[model samples]
Target chain A: MDAVLEADGLGKRYGNRWALRDCTFSLPEGQVAALVGPNGAGKSTLLHLAVGLLRPDDGSVRVLGQQPYDNVAVLPDLGFVAQDTPLYRDFTAAELVTMGGKLNRARWDASVARNRLAQLGIAPHQRVGTLSGGQRAQVALALALSKRPRLLLLDEPVASLDPLARHEFLQALMGSVAETGTTVLLSSHLLSDLERVCDHLVLLETAKVRLTGSVDDLLGTHRQLIGARHDGSAIPGVAAVIRESHTDRQSTLLVRVDGWVDETRWTSTEVGLEDLILGYLGDHRRQGSHAAWGVTA
Target chain B: MVIEFVLDGRSKVNTYMQLVQQVRQALRVGLLESGDQLPKVRDVAQALAINPNTVLKAYRQLEMEGLAEGRPGVGTFVTGTLAGASLMHQAELRADLVGWLRRAQTAGLTADDIVALVDTTIRATLADDVIVVTHT
Candidate 1:
């Protein structure tokens, strides 16, 4: 599979403090990948680096196998919607799309923008500033979709919207994905929302890549086990212990199983996507700097 | 397609499995018939706001089960009818089940409790080399 985005040893900082460090992940083309982490986990920083809004302070970042910074050649194929769905507040939807057409002349289709807004009941003449948050977000998404880009990077596009708005936004996004087979890497905190549209997962914690893989593969590899209290360090077939809790006579562990688990001795059950992610995040908090856990999905 | 799937986000069932089960249920109830087209993959994905691949996976599984067939350049169609002999007794069984559900509800079982009880009983009943007769 072709990599839509790639970063290696990526690092960034504000003044003396590093916002992101040692970050690395490759998102394959045509995969809707969920980029998740707590606030200040460098999700926005990583997205900026990929979208070429800012250059990395160290190492490298690539989009469509090319350095994205100042690369006009890649711009036509890449679409980005920054946080808060940024748009010129003064411009009407009509004028904004016309401007979008001029700026993205490579393959811009104005009808894609027009039709979407029309269906969404967002008037073309309505100034962006007067539109509700959801409407403005839709306009931004429509403009991005009109570019007909092969890749889209959305940074918390639906973070502020209500539930219905969020659903509508995702519906439009998924529709575009189905129609064009566009590769997307969107950052969001809504795991349930992500669970549906995202096939790939990239977890960032404390400025590092905690886990990233196809959701199906990750789910298959992780399990929750309960049994008599025992330190999880030497468990056979367990690739990594993500989280563990012990009582006087019992222990519960979430593990990444690389081989077969002895089902006869311990009760092993499947881990849902939410459980798998929370386990990793909790494990990271406890281990801090020197995480011995297997960091890959 | 006559049936439109509604997803329960909180359900423990996998999304694709839910889709497969919905289609099977539709078949058993005569909602979907032979030669009826399944909703297009893009339509279902867009409607449900889910990944297109998820819809494709469900369709693929349906095809694997001989319940559906895909035509190149055309849409998937219902190829197998699960309205078998057992389907004739479906109404009778449904009424009996409904009565039991009402009693269970009055007996103070919450939805989750009822689901757990039924699921455990099903597993215990279906244990060992029993026949797969409860196919619907």
Candidate 2:
């Protein structure tokens, strides 16, 4: 499969602290991959490295099979919307789209951006700063899509917007993806929102890549078992125990299973993306030891 | 009216599975029938603000199950039904079930308790088919 983004042994540091370390993952093209983790977990750092904002300290990063930073060819194919949705406050929405057209030499469709803003009910003549957070986001997204980039990278674009605005923004985004088949990698703390929009997931924890896989594959392979209290060692066909909790009478275990289990003794139930991601995040917090579980990158 | 699909993202069920089950349930209840057009993938994706690929996957699963078919340049249409009994028979059964449910509610049975009772009874009836044998 052609990967939209790939990283191998990627690491970044600020002063003595490492923001991201040994993060290696590949996202297949045409997938809306979610970059998720708690704060200070390097979600921003990874996205920055991919879009050429920051250079890696240890290993290589590739976007569309080419180095991102300072590469003219790769830069044209990438569109980035930062956390702030940075735009010239004084510029009208129309002027911003015009500026985006002038900036990208490869391909620019001014009407696409203009039409997008119009559809969002954002007046073309209104100053960007005067627009609400959501409208500002739509303008930023319009500018990005105007360039016709093959890959779009977003960093918490909806964190400040209200619920309705968030819905409108995502609806516009999904419509764009449906039309152009653009591969998107968006970093967000909103797990439920991610659950709605992302097909692939990359979970970071304490500056390391903890989990990365398609949402369907991940959910299908992991199971939640509710059974009588006993040592979990005897559970057959288990890959790794992601989380476990118990009472005197019964035990609940979240395990990644490679094959079928005896369903009669233990009620094996499927897990959703949020539960699967939370189980991994919670396990990392409770144990503080990834080594004990033997989770491979 | 077309059957409206709702997905609970927080539930243990996968989103695609939820969609597939909803379509099947709609078919069983006679809300959706053969030749009925399902919503376009993009329309559902935008309406629900979900990933388009998720909608595609669910539609594909439905196609695989022979419950729906997608025609190129056209929309997906329901091609099969889960309705086993005649419509009149099913309607009569549903009416009786509703009456019983009302009586159960008056008897102070919560919705959860009613579901649990029905689920346990169904499982017990199905368990009779499993014949465990021991080798001497």
Candidate 3:
């Protein structure tokens, strides 16, 4: 499998503060991956690095097996949708899409763009500024997709619209990916959404990856077990007991168990992605440790 | 293509779900067809101004339910043939409805009360059906 994105010992520093440090991960072509973290968790920094928007202080980054920054040949193969989603608000949707076609050296499929916009119910003749925020977003996205890039990088792509619009937008986006085979690296704060679209998840905190793997594998390894409350002191087979909720007769625990627990007494259930994330965040807070990263079993 | 998701205006359901439900309704109504390609996930995420991941989750669930499929190298697509999903989906929907009905029963609402509530709402909606007004 060819790697669509790769990084090694990646670090970014702002004066004395470290935004990201020793970050390492690679995503192959035909893979859809998500980067997840709390606000200011260096997710944007990582994305900037991957897309060649910003250079790293140390280490290297690549997109589609080539250096991403200012590399014209590689640039045409990639598409980027930023957080602010800048657009020429004065231009009409048709004018904006046409302008994108004129700017890109690669073939810009205008008909595809027009059809996609129409399917989304966005009027091509409407002025971008007069359009609603959601409609403006659609125009910008149409411009990006028109370019038909192989690798797409997006930062907080859907942080604005109302609920129904959000669903329509995502359905459209995923539908495109399924059709065009574009590999995407998306950064987001919504774990449930990530659980829905992403096969692989990269957990970032303090500028480094804490956990990275398939959702199924992560859930399989981490189990939440509920047992009789009185024997709650410590579980003999677990790796690390992080959180515990107890009652008079029964106790539920979030524990990192070593290997597998095939025991009948323990009612085991797979921990959700959100639960695992919250546990990671909570553990980070409790250790009183900053600038340190650890992957849970 | 008969996709349906819950949308509660004031309940604890998140906004992204409302988005999901509406899309499902569109599919159910034939507003979006089997061969129709959806907008890119990022594009939709950007338009709705919600988390891309939430939208992704909805798409993924739809895929798992066989209403959608994410073709490797291609984008996500609506299933051309929904015939394969009918039996499994029927069982799943039944189980889900049973769970909800059980909760309604526990809340002290009788079946008669529920039926009466539906009847009144339907009557109010149909009251203006015979009225005609001039067009501008």
Task: For each candidate, give the TM-score of chain B.
Answer: 0.65, 0.72, 0.49
Best by lDDT: 1
List where candidate 1 sits over 4 angstroms from the true fold: A286-297, B86-136
Q: Write candidate 1's Cα lDDT for A1-297 as tens digits.
A: 489888899999999988889988888888999999989889999999888888889989988888888878889988999999989999999999999988988899999999999998888788999998988888999999999988899999899999998999999998889888999999999888998899999999888889999999999999999998986558889988888999999999999999998888789999888888888998746534444564643
When candidate 2 is compared with the true two-chain complex, its DockQ is 0.60
User: What local lDDT does model 3 show for residue A30?
Assistant: 58
Q: Pick the candidate with the highest DockQ.
A: 1
- State the C-alpha lDDT per candidate: 0.90, 0.89, 0.72
Interface RMSD (Å) of candidate 3: 7.4
Kindly report which residue stretches of model 3 are placed more than 4 angstroms away from their true locations once superposed.
A228-251, A256-258, A286-297, B1-136
Better of 2 and 3 by lDDT: 2
Range of the 10 consecutive residues with the lowest summed lDDT in candidate 3 chain B:
B1-10
TM-score per candidate, chains pooled = 0.86, 0.83, 0.66
What's the ranking of the predictions by TM-score, best on top?
A: 1, 2, 3
lDDT of predicted model 1:
0.90
lDDT per residue as tens, model 2, B1-136? 3977887855667777888999999998889999999988887887788899988999999999999999997989999998986875987888999999999999999999999999887777866787434459
